[model samples]
Target: MIQKIPPGPVTMSDWNFVIVEYQGHVVEKFLGYYYELQHIRFSSQVIEYDPQSNTGKTWSGSKYFFLDRPGPLYPLAQIYLAHFSRNEGIRVRLKYQG
Candidate 1:
């Protein structure tokens, strides 16, 4: 019998991965994953994968921050504001969803 590999643990993908740093000190890191599933909001809480359990759980709430600006907005501005208010560096990475 051929052994089968179980599915990988849940992880946020195809969004932005940001590392927050303040005054040369690492504050926190956040991962944002967005997807449209059946026209409903499908967002991951952005958690670290637990290899043993094959699941992901919320790591740190401070790591992720959501913007609630209204009207037209720019991506750069949003990021900049987030940095200034949150006081952290950001690293953006694309997540691959199959």
Candidate 2:
């Protein structure tokens, strides 16, 4: 599933398995569908920019949190792992037809 990212908040609905890392270290790995996941969210939020500091670090309270409020982002190359058995390529099933 590949698509152009829009210039707005992007929300992921049905997804599982999210790996969070920090400074090349694995912080946490979420393993479960969207409905089963807890606490954290998977929506894109805006970063507040400050002209004086010449940096953006602020976040919206609605979808963003820090420390106890939420978390941060980083740069890394994502690698997906799939089961390679006699079944062949990655198996996918659609729940919606529309």
Candidate 3:
């Protein structure tokens, strides 16, 4: 299911919820959290990304895996939001790799 992020500041982490692009559509999946200084194992499901609308369909029961382990998606920022804050997550931008 696509977990809609609330309107506020947020951060990305390993095994955390992520929205990525796939086949010309944006998808939300739970692979691994952001660890170290790069995003690794971007292998998971690619739901559907609709920037114009705020709606989601049922699960498509599909999965995709990317072998690009270029480290964390974003760099550690100097500050972070409360909702976006985590024990392991650092203050950084949320990057979606399709």
Q: What's the true lDDT of residue 3 in model 2?
A: 30
Candidate order (lDDT): 3, 1, 2
Candidate 3 lands at a TM-score of 0.23
Full-model lDDT for every candidate = 0.33, 0.26, 0.34
For model 1, the local distance difference test gives 0.33
RMSD of 3: 14.1
| lDDT (tens digit, per residue) of candidate 3 on 11-77 | 2342333554435666454444333324422334435423344222224432322233322332222
RMSD of each: 14.3, 14.1, 14.1
> Which digits, one per residue and each the tens of the lDDT, describe model 2 over residues 9-62?
222222332333335543222111122223223323234523353222213332
Off by over 4 Å in 2: 20-23, 27-98
**Ranking of models by TM-score:** 1, 3, 2
Q: Candidate 2 local accuracy as lDDT?
A: 0.26
**True lDDT of residue 59, candidate 2:** 33
* Clash numbers, per candidate: 6, 4, 15
